[model samples]
Target: MKRLIGAGLAVVLVPVLLLSMLVAVLFGSEDEAQAAPPGGQPGVVCTTAPASGSGGSAGSTTGQDVAGFSGDQLDNAAVIVGQGKALGVPERGWVVAVATAMQESTLRTLNYGDTMANGQMSSSRGLFQQLDAWGPLADRLDPAKSAAMFYTGGQAGQPGLLDIPGWEQLPVTVAAQRVQQSETPDAYAKWEQPANQVVGAVEGRTCTTTPAAGAAGGTSISLPSNPRAETVINRALSQLGVTYSWGGGDANGPTLGIHDGGVADAHGDYAKVGFDCSGLALYAYAGIGVAVPHQTQAIWAAFPHLTDRTTLQPGDLLLYSSNGAANGIHHVGIYLGDDRMVEAPQSGDVVKISSGIWGGNRGAEFIGAVRPGA
Candidate 1:
């Protein structure tokens, strides 16, 4: 059993989950994104934003579990939290939303919902058990849409989380109760801890504000002292100016990208031939026979990650995460000494050297450096 800390109180959490419900559909999706490179390199050609649509990532740690959250469950959690972020829901709102989902549907996107009084089956469905009054059935089924509805509410009479006055000051259960109106209003409290864990894991480190001063500009590469490192840098640098395709690039070379169902899709990344953040890193390292998986987190764990960013050398992969933890890693780049790095940033951008480790990419926290073949 674990203990969950809340507003001046703590609640014991039973590690085991008791399922009294049926399984339902799960949801999530992703790739990676970025900004510019060194001097006068036809960098990020387009800055205009794409048409708004659904967006999701397969959560950072998709293949693993966290706090007993399986890949699917975690993926759904990611969607819920991601949708919250897109709608400007604060972190507190994210916790409340996830906790409510845990109590209502155990984080699964349910096809069936609760039955209310008078013997008629309530039309509640989806992750938060939204009802027929919440809008169309399709919106309730999509994790992203459902999450958006949960945070923003639907229909004329219904109100979402933010619509509840003082929701920020309320406890997880209280806030959730205002939105869900569950029979067991207090049930949301027990999930507070796990919900926090889920949100933190999915949201990761985000820095909207500028980072502290560090090496930032100039496209010139200062080749690493190590031959292996030099080789990797050369190969990565060769790909400079390449378009950034979500899920594109591999150990062999650039490949087709997968759909992200949102901004990336609008940018037509799925049809482009190029590399994403980690894909570029893995492909570059392949030149030196250093085979790492295409995923950022995998590459982070595949080699010795430097604890001190100041010790970075050329060809070392700089890892960034949504959260500061390893499990939150989502992007990677080739470190080209003097604070410069090459990366395939995001939709509508090209492979280029950034001014610093945190250059071009917003909301991505610079975690550390991964030296492949070190």
Candidate 2:
């Protein structure tokens, strides 16, 4: 009896020790891990901006009156101009509007749900998200007008502007909060540096007050720099009539969304393996110098502007509605021009290029156009 009891205690005690060890491993402190560099690699600044370009002289800036921002803030005014111009806003007004948008939205046209209550999110939309219900509003839903109005008329003395003190004289962030009445007033300030850099690169300007390049002479609606953009478009076109897969947008992906890295299988045709919406863009731009993100929201956030479908160009990204009944981006494709696009299609299909079709219907929601290399 004594021997049997001792053996039973050993079995229970051994498992208890192992279980404690497992718990220790599983619940180990994460602070040390966070302190370590990502992927166990050190010396990487995860948030560094891309290198600037040698893209020539940015002209003078003439826009709404802004006084409080530091002179250095104007460095990226050109990128803001190029970005705003893409959105169809005038250059002078573009600077002011961009400053405001950088203040309000950080130049990103987000689709995520906002904290603002009421229908401001529903009726008012895009980068500015201005509401039509607001008195004397210009197509408030339009990013251009909304940005302009927000910039030009944002005043602290105004009733709604009271939330932001000294808004008119404050930096873009303060002014934007006054106009937007956002719960978080300081959010827009984070974009100041990046917004300025992008604007300066695209517009070729040193400051918001500089004379802008002949507005019409700058930025033609032309092809971006992805050298392989044309090649991939051609390759995808060669695979027309392939069936669609759920996650099957790349060459190496299985069916759809089946492959790792979200790349579709190459389907073993031209050895043209692994290309999803981002993959296609990546390969295309790799031919040039730029690299795009893989995910849809990241791609949208990285791009310059939301362009109209009528002005679609080769290598432009085409997004389709996903939210059952013509809303929310569920799929994406590459525009090959001439109303033709290259896409993975849907489930039961291999990676192939064909006339665009979204959910068995030709009238897929045209989310917007993106110029891959500007």
lDDT of 1 at 368: 85
RMSD of each candidate? 20.7, 26.6
TM-scores of all models? 0.40, 0.30
Worst-scoring 10-residue span by lDDT in model 2: 13-22
Q: What tens digits encode model 1's per-residue C-alpha lDDT throughout 260-321?
A: 99988999998766688888888887877978788888888888768675565556677888
**TM-score attained by model 2:** 0.30
lDDT digits (tens) for residues 244-308 of candidate 2: 33333333211223543333344432222223454444444544456666566566667775556
Clash count, one per candidate? 14, 40
CA lDDT scores, all candidates in order: 0.62, 0.38
lDDT of 1 at 238: 48
Off by over 4 Å in 1: 1-225, 358-364
